[model samples]
Target: MGSNEYFTEAVVLDKEPSGEFDSIAHLYTQELGRVSASVTSARKILSKLNSHLEPLNLVQVRLVEKNRFHVADVLKTGALDRQHLDALKLIKSITPEAQPDPELWHLIKTNLNEKDILSILGFDSQFAACLGCGLKKDLRFSINDLSYFCVACYDRLL
Candidate 1:
């Protein structure tokens, strides 16, 4: 590795097109927390990094930092299922950029559950109640307001 380059374990949170062939990938890294890195040629069919950078995949990434972070290489370390993908989405939504939280990282790497994630983020489920009706049954968390709502109340807003 070059002086400017470093490697870390990361979860591919999301990716979006940039310019034409390149992309900006959002990664939740063990060392760097949530980071957005530029991935060159990511949209091209034959790009090696494209497949490994898919959302919710656990990867070992080589990143170079200059004006901004850039992904030089990626190796998929683990493939997560759909349920884990949903948890990853929630993690992406709540976490801020470039702030490493070891607790959150461990949660991401383990048997993930919403209650534990919420607790690590400083939300106490014991006091949680539906924002619409103040009932606690069948509560689902809303990332938008960092609160909980019952299933019926949450569905009503949709």
Candidate 2:
């Protein structure tokens, strides 16, 4: 590896075409948190990173950090299902840049269930507190309100 280049495990969050042939990929890494990497010639037919750069794909990437990250190599790759990919998108949409949370990483690596979505996004404590004065164990999520409430509180609102 070059002096400036380093390898890290990352998950692809989004990608946007850049210039004519290059592309920029947004990644959430275990070490560097969220970063945008430049994939040179990414739109070309022979681009190796093309197959590994899709959303929700876990990859081991070699990067050099300058004004923006430049991808040197993609060492490995893993992918999620359509539903899990959607959940990952949701997670990425709300996540801020350069913030690393091991809990979130673990959730992405292990399970992609919607039930864990709230917690994975760092809303569990707040959701729990929203449930009937903050002491309810059987809290239910409310899509309409975008929060959680105990059965009694949920009933009262209805």
Candidate 3:
């Protein structure tokens, strides 16, 4: 492969229309943590890349980086359920670009829970207590505040 070309396993995070016939795909890749790549003519009706690059799909992708990254090819490897799609969204929200974390990648590739993901992001919940009631049990994490709150406290806030 050329120096500017990269091949990696990636999970599709999201996609958005770019111009008239192109799209910008957000991917969390095993080799490059997160990247946005342009897909030429991906908005067309017969776009093969568009179907393979749907949100939460696991794919092998070839990316060419010139002034910016562009998708050269993609092959769908797996499809994730709605629950996993939610996890992918959380991963996209937390991770930075081009900072690959093998542990995080493994967590995404396998059966995972929110706790595992939060731990990978350095927010361990084992010793966490409710911010309002100081109770650890039956707590839900608040990403907005980076705190845990018991069900009662959380319900009250909502």
Best by TM-score: 1
TM-score against truth, every candidate: 0.85, 0.69, 0.81
CA shift of 8, model 1, Å: 0.6
Model 1 misplacement above 4 A = 1-4, 41-46
* Cand. 3 Cα-lDDT: 0.85
Stretches of candidate 2 above 4 Å error? 1-4, 41-46, 125-158
What lDDT would candidate 1 get against the real structure?
0.85
Candidate RMSDs in Å, in order, are 2.9, 5.4, 3.1
Alpha carbon lDDT of each predicted model: 0.85, 0.75, 0.85
Across residues 56-127, which tens digit of lDDT does each residue of candidate 3 receive? 899999999988899999999997777876677777777778899999889888875678988888877888
91-133 per-residue lDDT for model 1 (tens digits): 8898888899999888788777778888888876788899999
